[model samples]
Target: MKYFRANRPLTINEVQKFAPAAFADKASLDVSKNYSFLSTRNLIETLEKKNIVPFAVAQTKSRTDEAKESGRHLIRFRHENHKLEIGEVVPEIVLETSHDAKSSFKFSLGLFRLICENGLVAPCSILDTIRIKHVKADDSDVIDAAFEVLDSSDSAIENILEMKRKVLSIDDRFSFANEATTLRWEKESDCPHLPLEKILAPRRRKESELDLWTTFNVVQENLVRGGLSFYKLNDKGYPIARQSTRAVNSIAKNLELNRNLWTLANKFLNN
Candidate 1:
């Protein structure tokens, strides 16, 4: 059975302590007889700790008109820093009532943001409200709808880049801005040849079915031709940055490099 993402699974320790016995004992008070009594209290305490307490009691749900008027809604999860993490992927709230009007369906809904980009920093840039929803029946259908919602929200990605800029600035690094995106001095220093401006430019279209392997080969070819060392050395490292950094640098190294990736990227973009 599929469990809700909002509700994570119980830990091993939790399961071991609260597990019930198969049969009841005859002589003394059966520990298994009151299994629900022991488990229910523990479950409630665990949920409270995680801030995932049920929204309403069993058979008691609120059905308000405000829940019906839906478009985009933010679902916030309390984080470690006394902060609430709003999912960058936005979700819509829907309320469905039963024919008898005795039951209601309410869930925070949105698409998962599955961004594939050349840079770790760029993909991690997303920050805002994130919504968690379970696929009631058709998982693939729900995923498709989520992608559609992610494709629609340009502001969400913009906000992520903006947050990244502020973080860089606080570290006393000089930041170079191009419209909505920024690059820090440290990132620029290591790869001074990179054209910082164009790389961070938000894509004209959000979703692309580009094969990353093909893109990597294209980038490797470009790097080989451009004379930039594909391998960089760290304190105790050998090419720790991996392909993502290689691709980002390959595109940002020169205008001609970007053109090459774009020229190759078009092959996948078209399909």
Candidate 2:
């Protein structure tokens, strides 16, 4: 995906005109009544007025050959520091298809962690998200709702920082690995489960830092990106070495892993 830094807010028409290839496929005239289009241009203007400058935009289609209505655009903003680190805030506005009704449009919030650049959807438990049902809301309402969430990012940053400050012991790390393994392989009876030792293996020497933040990333990398090894039967009926694939491939899985991992880490602090 090509990302362009926005110096000023651009309207949907301007975005389409500027990047015809990305937004070339226009929505059909009969697009679903439930779907409503948010004013990207107005959103940008609102963000800029609040000193929230958009730094990047990504356009993607839900599937190949799908109409433009199925396409989504991601707008990203750096909360304060451009540097990536734990507790640093990166907010993203996703304009995409609505779940309430097919053929309608909605905008959702996503967050990015600097440590691993992991993108997290804003959990309803944490952040207030705006859902604009075309039937009930107008463009101004969408803009107002989006600003409400963006303005409350300070609280979100505080939550992230609190998590980062809590340290994890060596035993806690191992326990986390075991719990993560259970979460990853609870359904796969045929697959050989990875051992806790292997899950705790560090990809880099620096990753051995004894903290909940680093430990979570180390284990998460191994589970989601696949760096560990396991055995499988070959055609000759002999055990052969096989590399593990991503444990979480879909968005739902990603969200589950992130939420569960954080919840697990939070337990240590609570205790």
Tell me the tens digit of each residue's lDDT in model 2 across 1-271. 3444443444556555433323433344556765555455555666667666455455543544453433445455444334555645576554333222342444445566555555555545465445566575566886676666666666656666666787877788888888777666666664464678788887777667777766766777677766577767676867777756554544335545655665665566466
Q: RMSD, each candidate, Å?
A: 20.2, 5.3
Off by over 4 Å in 2: 1-31, 40-45, 48-69, 79-116, 120-125, 128-130, 181-186, 190-192, 233-238, 247-256
lDDT by residue (tens digit), candidate 1, 1-271: 0111222333434322322110111212222332221112333344346443321111112254322221111121111122223323322211111112122112222222223212111121222222223213222333333334335336434433433333222112112222111122234345533333223223334322123322222233333233333345466655554222332322123223322333333333233
Q: Which candidate is the best by lDDT?
A: 2
TM values, all candidates:
0.20, 0.66
Residue 242 in model 2: lDDT: 71
The list of candidate 1 runs beyond 4 A from truth reads 1-188, 207-271
Tell me how far the alpha carbon of residue 31 in candidate 2 is from the true structure, in angstroms, after superposition.
Answer: 4.1
